[model samples]
Target: YKETLSGPTRLISIDGADHTFGSIPWQEELFSNTLEFILANLS
Candidate 1:
């Protein structure tokens, strides 16, 4: 995960969040950022 990104990439570390992101308050942010990234890259 750390070696692949050499150029354009976004790495967001959510504090107090785990891999599942279950029952977490910042889950909304995770979804929001994912949507934003997808929308931004769409052609």
Candidate 2:
């Protein structure tokens, strides 16, 4: 399924994180990584 993507792609897995990111630390990590990715891709 991922083979059809056209640009930069990433996969992040957080230990002990459920589908909803039910923990504070896991949520923080998810948000932090997402923000970093967005910033890096900005022109």
Candidate 3:
């Protein structure tokens, strides 16, 4: 599924993270990765 993307793409999986990111550390990881992706892609 991820292979068909047209532009920049990122795949992240947080260890011990559930679907809802129901913990602080997991949520932080998610947010940090998201921000990194966004910053890297910005023109």
Candidate 4:
């Protein structure tokens, strides 16, 4: 499912993350990545 992006796509992986991020320890990393992505695309 990570092979269909058109452009400007990023695929981040949290070692122990699951589909729902349940009990995951990388939630902060997830949010940070998301925010960085958004900020970088802002014009």
The residue-level lDDT of candidate 3 at 12 comes to 43
Provide the lDDT at 33 for model 3. 77
TM-score of each: 0.41, 0.44, 0.44, 0.40
Worst 10 residues of 4 by lDDT: 1-10
- lDDT by residue (1-43, candidate 3, tens digit) is 3242223342344332344455557556756677677778895
Q: Write the per-residue lDDT of candidate 4 for residues 1-43, one digit (tens) a residue.
A: 3432222343344333345455544755665577577778984
* lDDT of all predictions: 0.50, 0.50, 0.50, 0.50
Ten-residue segment with the worst summed lDDT in candidate 3? 2-11
Residue 34 in candidate 3, Cα distance off native in Å: 0.1
Candidate 3 has which clashing residue pairs, if any?
none
C-alpha positional error of residue 12 in candidate 1 after TM-score superposition, expressed in Å: 22
Tens-place lDDT per residue, model 2, 1-43, is 3331223332343332345455557656755687577779894
Stretches off by above 4 angstroms in model 3 are: 1-23
Residue 6's lDDT within candidate 1 is 26
The better-scoring model by TM-score among 1 and 2 is 2
Runs with alpha carbons beyond 4 Å of true place in candidate 1: 1-23
